[model samples]
Target: MRVKDSATDPNAIAVDSPAGTASPRVAAPRTGGGTLLAALGVAAFSLTFPATVWALEGLGPWSVTTCRMVLAGLLAGACLLAGRVRPPARRHLLPLLTVAGGTVVGFPLLTTLALRTSSTSHAAVVVGLLPLTTAAYSAVRTRAGHSRTFWAAALTGAAVVIAFAVRESGGRPTTGDLFLFGALLVCAAGYSEGGRLARELPGWQVIAWALVLCLPVASAGAALSLRTEPVHLTGHAVAGLLWLAVGSQFVGLWIWYRGMAAIGVARASQLQLAQPLLTLVWSVLLLGERLGPAAPVAAVAVLVCIGVTQRTRS
Candidate 1:
């Protein structure tokens, strides 16, 4: 994530162009095109919480989570097979499992459960801390260093979300907040690891492999849950399920990992600073959730913090 200039940092991943040898203007492109890709990925991910809410209209929490994974896994499997991708080497298995456990199982299940009790707007703000958490994970795992300015900004962003949660919940966090915070932790770990892996492999391959690995378990869970969960299958519910499967889980991660590969993990993550605000707009427009005045203030505060981190991170 915080790749020291590849020239100086021996541990930094060498990013070669498609021809195997790359241009010297790596830094320029990373800041430009890479940032754009990450921004697009953020836009895609912003809809996830609202989509999950819509999905809950017709499906049980467990059913929605499992069904979402199953569908994404199938799509990922199709992509892999179409391209005749080779199986991952044994060395990649553990990290792949980590990715699958966190992104595929942990984040989705926890957030879905939380959505049962939480407003999408509230949930969006709570999960807004993800960029800071992800950058922290990337720093630790990669043993990269960030400037004090970067840490200060990141911590301020986190503090804003925490304070907002407390204020909203009458000085105490709710069950939904707890679930979302847990989702925050695991998802950060998965995202940082996936970003790291993306450097060595194609971005899509990383998410695809992780999703495919969980296909069997997800399918089984979905099948059993379908028997127990009441379902009405309204247009909103079906559309939400389709978007969650294809848009958020699969395509979004694919784009995100590619961005992480192009830029560093830390910088790409900062781009996610705007995600919560986007989700807020979606919650209002799509889900018709009302937001208190504090939500926008906190969202804008977090957005400002990311601006500092992007400029100061080194």
Candidate 2:
């Protein structure tokens, strides 16, 4: 997920950054550190699906989702308090809520639910669409115009992802597939909104504030989930849960949004093209899942499409 500034011209394409912040425009040069930061963020996120799967072995999806949020929120709150950060301006409240709803609530819940039925490998393929979705949301939010080549590349990538899903599921969509798709959309929106706010607020602070904002809801949900499901935590499950709370939800966004703020959303988002491949590797190594011959082919195709889309001018 990412955020940035809006364009003055309705037809002009601009990357979202904080107002008064400097970020590379589409044609501008990108910094090496920004690219590396974005890559690191992707590497962190790549483990999310598999980790969630490991977590589910000992906990219900609701338990994992809500507990992760509550824990991460507490960490974020501590960060805020330690930094002595003032509350956001009243005007910033709604966007922070948007970030909270999509990422803090929607993405984790939906993906965890999806993982109940879907393999980690399949979910990784679905998540491959995230960069494209984030780009689309950024385009709409910024009211930016895209060239025909850009749209064609974006549509082509979408088509490839859809086809891969269909082929994987024996030509029929599964419940997990639907849930993962929903996760992709909501996460994209959250990323875009958070990236936008990162311009004015520090990237870490943007997610920290969003997490803190949702703490009450997260606490309630976690309590209710535990009451209903009664998780018996194992060492692996505990590790998985902590990874989600600290690595993916908190530190990952700290790096990701900063990369987006520095390099612009478009370029930063492109780095996520590597995410699916990394996820596939993690799934096989960590989860002991076997990769089919088709998996690598699909991953390469998706990466090529993403590269094409990234190169197209908006």
Top candidate when judged by lDDT against the true structure = 1
Give the TM-score comparing model 1 with the true structure, all chains together.
Answer: 0.88
Top candidate (TM-score): 1
Model 2 Cα displacement at 173 (Å)? 2.2
lDDT of each: 0.80, 0.76
Q: TM-score for every candidate vs. truth?
A: 0.88, 0.85
Overlapping backbone residue pairs in candidate 2 total 11
Over 1-314, each residue of candidate 2 has an lDDT whose tens digit, in order, gives 13324321212234434565444433222456656777788889999988898899889999999999999999999999999999987767988998888888899999899889877766765666787788778888878667777667666666665566456545655678778878888888888887766766778888999999989988998999999996888988999999999999999988887677656666567667667667877888998876566767767776786677556655
User: Native-vs-model 2 lDDT?
Assistant: 0.76
Native RMSD of candidate 2 (Å): 4.7
TM-score for candidate 2, residues paired by index = 0.85
- Per-residue error for 205 in candidate 1, Å, reads 0.8
